[model samples]
Target: MLQDTIKAQLKGYLANLAHPVVLEASLDDSAPSREMHELLHEVAALSDKVQVSEQGVATRRPSFVIRRADATGQGMAGVTFAAIPMGHEFTSFVLALLQVAGHAPKFSDDVIAQIRALPGKYAFETYVALSCQNCPDVVQALNAMSVLNPNIHNTTIDGALFQDEVAARNIMSVPQVYLNGEPFETGRADVEQILAKLDADAPRRAAERLKDIAPFDMLIIGGGPAGASAAIYAARKGLRTGIVVERFGGQVMDTDGIENFISVKETDGPKLSAALEAHVRQYDVDVISSQRASELFPAAQPGGLHGVALESGAILHARTVILATGAHWRHLGVPGEEEYRNRGVAYCPHCDGPFYKGKRVAVAGGGNSGVEAAIDLAGIVAHVTLLQRGSHLKADKVLQDKLYSMPNVTVLTEALTTRIEGNGKNVTGLTYRGGDGADHHLDLEGVFVQIGLLPNTGWLKGTVRLTDFGEIVVNDHGATSIPGIFAAGDATTTPYKQIVIAIGDGAKAALSAFDYLIRVPATGEKHAAVLETAAK
Candidate 1:
């Protein structure tokens, strides 16, 4: 049954829809199909702009063919909804109807020209999950692109309904886009990224021109909050700054909820990432996207330029460098773990814990992160099972005390997670072994692997003095062992890994770099010219 308030709201939205739209629902006699049909029928009854019709033959299971409406409420050349479009995708579905009705898409002239120039027919198969909050961004972006270009067609498939396809394609996360038959980008890819992917020669062209780039005053590595903040701060100081990122937003893009960013009480990862990007865009920071730094060459002499070679064969030289590359959660390498990632398995409890409210979940490992995640999940979920393979928990005494005090928390020691079991679409449960070598099975909604974090510093092994754990060693002023190069955020030796901490780290690094630039005399007038330009 549809919520009355939601139905009312949708009715208003449908009434204001400029172009006519029809819902061609095709369902079998199955319970799920019948339920979906009734839901659509109820929705159609709300507004004259929306009309529903039943089809005898179903092209896909419990599918709805949304199309442009004629005077008689008939449509053709429409988008298909293979499952009940709920969660974040509901808005995308509404927007798609509007797009089909001849509403002009809001794309810049540059993006429009790129889409128009795309050769031949290309199909964008976007896979989404109803619960994924960021799925709509990619789906809507593709939908808008489809409307602007005649050669491009977009189809959205609900990953939950097409579990077989999800498993076959190894789509661990939502908003996974497939261009033609090959796998394209994952997660929320911007329209520019999509266009770049569409253009096959873009990488080669970018690679060929890498050496022709100008040097910058500050070259910030990574595009996470720290890097973004550093870039903005450096740019505001009138320094010619540039940021190189494999993808913008860094690890923030993979995250979900961002609560403790100061002043902001609530915000999702994608939203916060978008804000960070938008803020950087307002500055004069040169954003080099979709490129990874392969090598870092420190200055041979004092006040000399430090050069970083990118994977794209482009080398960027800067007087100062800031390392804000973040870390990623370490996975438990168990069977089905990778397949069910973001399905019935998750890493960040802060990000995905709310999705499993009132459901049973497990936290692997007994480290500080594991115990903390278990404590956090116990508040929202019905129960939290903490699994530790070691003989003793590695978390602090205070954290262990808090975890023990929680009634909903269950602690299992000397346990090994043998496998993660899931139904093709969602995680059903998991198999583990107890201390006595006895097998145990738990019917859980989700599993959170919180073994630990691995800092993204493999590429900086030789260039920087790193701790044994690969975190860059830094001082109180965010200065690394090497001069003219500073480290910040999760990539540094900062004890705390919070967003606010990372932001402060970024500010510190940028300020330290500015101080170094003022003291050091580098070779050539390029740096002087940049400073002069900034002064003007």
Candidate 2:
């Protein structure tokens, strides 16, 4: 009876209010229980004006249908609630309603209209840390997107909510957005980037019309040695595997020759990549190239974890994900560096060294990579100049000794490359500053930059743990701190960054992922059965 009284009062309050009413539920009130029950009926009656649903509680279908109808109506006009928005997400939820109501502080009408036209159901969940200043912008962008498409529902969960839905997803940071239960965008995403994701995730007519389907077994990002190797091993083990890469070979595409890969005496990088691709293709692996992974998120819940998202704008679902994007060499931003790239300037000496054979080349940097490249090139090239910006070389004593012993190698201490001198077609030479503050010019055919490498983990912010240098930190078994997500290859913080080591790490990661799948024991029964049959 008390519940009935409070429900009447609440309805009267909402009916008379000039603006949308915001109510905070209090767990301490005995009247709240009665009020909540009574409120549900009142909310159902007001279904034409407002919508309400509980997140943690199991609600009845009639109540939910009424709430959804009201929500959809409000959504058409740009108004909706997060139902459980708290902590850092509280502000975002309110802002989302305002943006949907066409009251957003930012964003133009054109962007909003484009978002509204987007097809398919999209669930956008953003995980954010309280300290992120740019998070509001992301929220605004999402709200604008919601305004464009009422089907796009945006949910902002604070870092603490990991105890609920996010903990199961294994999300590590804030401002991490998940679409349809998969991590979509981490950190700040611009309007264009978000729209691109929506386009990628919009399903085809056939997929859109379908109701129920099974998720993928494995989703491998990057088609390099690690990704390809993972796909091959997983497929051989009878798991349905899918691989997505911006390009087939990754950084290895630029590699001209690779002598260190085991069993193969010496082969070109492209050939090795092609062979790996063919090996995986012979199995059940689905290879997708010229596509980039734009997002990753948790799929199911509790024990078994899986998720899906897009590369560019194509939505893909998978049970497991292996990130093997690999590492990219840091570039020295100088004039003509881009034009001379692949012609006279290169990052990988092992890949492009043969082209500079019998010609003068300058190796930049003072680290082990530079010294090693210089030593290796001294044997093949006619002359090599090791340029060190520091006063002394930073390589180990053994490499330093080897560099000194090379007759054709010239050590230029405190030498800093100022410009890459090259014609429109090819490199001719370079200018540098010597230790004595004197300018020096080297007439060279190639400039091999053996500087440090940067892992492709920038997109992972707020989603996974990263080292100070931005490499993904993994355990001994290649398992990242984020459960169900494994990383390998040069992108990891492992000591050895060689092709052989990367392959070994890839194998370990694949095995670790397999173990995770086994522990879950939910979906892969067919795969396990297939494996057993093959063994027999």
Candidate 3:
């Protein structure tokens, strides 16, 4: 029976085989030849999955033949083959295989039942790293899911084979999946994540829901210190201010206690964030939280200004934009990192340090932030273990001296955190092994990672030029290479990421934006009025 099933699946795949057609195009042409090159590369990756007749011509035959163990020679039970399944439509290929394999799709009862019961169009694309050991499980799971519902079309791709395609689509990591050309998940995601993506990507059926959004005088893209400062100043200027943030407090929310922020004697991160939100609300600032800006484009032809598109399908038109989208804390990328986050594990000392005031806490990284956080937390926290992956601390002498002077602060050089242990919801402690082979687990309430930050500018690919370090390059007045689109705060290559520095830069960007708008009218209202009078 198994052999018969395998043979049946193989026959289905063989019947759908397609011969790949290649076209030679010049790079110096007016047309988009680059797109063709990407398609060719995608085809090449499937060379192993399909039978090749020529250099670029391949008969898209079943790449693999599967047979059931119990089937007889006359009748085939189970068999399957995968063709070139990558790029934007890779998920469809996966679904096709699942149908042939004769297995129900692996999804929740509601989703599976809905797919089985309803009659509608469902499209999806899944990207996966072929070399990744964990990818096949996800692929098989998704295949099972596709089989349960005939309406769903799934596409799969070998992530490594399509470098140009990945680059064009701005994919950073795999299994970086997408639905309907928008982001879905990245790296070893579960079924729930995929389901959530499907729900989010579902098209809206109502036209009346779409309203004419008002153009903003200034649209800030982050809710961190930089974005908040920009929003405050821009609102004061009486411009229609709007701040779009994926998270309200940005990386600062991870901090336990913020002592560096000017004027605040001693404050926690949540309190500071609340205050900022309240202050912005007092003005005419419209703060939209938990929404990411997916794309940015010129508002008018000939580069009049820029507009932003949010993940929620909201279109934001603005005369000026301040990209205060700050940076995110670097992670250890080790096991249990995600599981321990916000429990006993944390990214900011300013945000979570107070919770470990009487208990022990570990601070990873030896940089300035690490040193500063350790020094500040040493006074309040009972014991502080500063774990440095390197041999030495990369902070200033004064800060280093203060840290060493504290009897409770123990600087562990060449130490790396391998795993974090927690009590389900919160972190209980951590396990670390030194370069010298000394393993230790300290009983602690929290762990603060003070590693450097990575700017959240991955979405700015092709739209804006960034520095080598992925930071948005801007001039002294926060004017980006693209006019009318300025950037401030940590996301920009403006050196310091301190609150005071970010505030000053934010103000400068606002003033510069105001100046640019006066010189270049975005709506062409003044020019249109002049033309109308001239016609009269």
Local error of candidate 1 at residue 522 (angstroms): 2.6
Q: Write the per-residue lDDT of candidate 1 for residues 1-536, one digit (tens) a residue.
A: 87999988888777777876678887887887887788788878887777887862556677876666663322144366776877667778878877776777766665677777878877778887676766777888887777676566677887767778876875555677888888787766767677777787766666665656788899999999899889999999999999987666677776556666789999877778879888998999888877788778787666877878776666778899999989887878889998887787887675456567788999998988789889988998999999999898999899999999999999999999999999988898999999999999999989999887789999998878999999999999999999899999998999978788888889889999999999999873333323332344
Which structure is stronger by TM-score: 1 or 3? 1
lDDT of 1: 0.80
**Tens digits of lDDT, candidate 3, 1-536:** 12445445544553443322122222322222334344334443443333222222122221222222222441221222222334222333434433443434544455565445545545455655533323443455455554455455455554344445655774433455565677656544434345545554432311112225567778899987778888988888788888987656666654555677777789755467657777777898876655688777654442343567666565566778899888877888877778766446666554334445487888898988899989878987899999998889999898898899999999998898888887776667888888888888877767887789999998887767798889999998898877778999999999978767877888888888877767775662212322232234
Give the alpha-carbon lDDT of every model. 0.80, 0.64, 0.62
Model 1 TM-score, all chains together? 0.74
Between candidates 1 and 2, name the one with more favorable lDDT. Answer: 1
lDDT of 2 by residue, 1-536 (tens): 22566456545544543234222222222443444445444544642334443442322111111122223353453323322333333355445434433354454454555576787787776655433433554665675666566676564444432335544664433456788877688655656567756676533321332223345577788888888888888888888788876555566654545777888899765567657767777898766544566555543352343443443334555657788989888888877788776567876665345445588999998898898889878987999998989889999898899899978989988888989997666789999977788878889888998878889878777666899988988999888776678888988888877777877887888888888887875643223322232244
lDDT of 3 at 236: 84
Q: Model 2 — TM-score against the truth?
A: 0.50
Name the regions of candidate 2 deviating beyond 4 angstroms: 1-214, 247-249, 252-268, 299-308, 334-336, 339-344, 348-360, 366-383, 390-408, 421-446, 521-536
Best by TM-score: 1
Question: Clashes in model 1: which pairs?
Answer: none
lDDT comparing candidate 3 with the true structure: 0.62
RMSD of 3: 20.5
Please report, as a residue range, the 10-residue window in candidate 1 with the lowest summed lDDT. 525-534
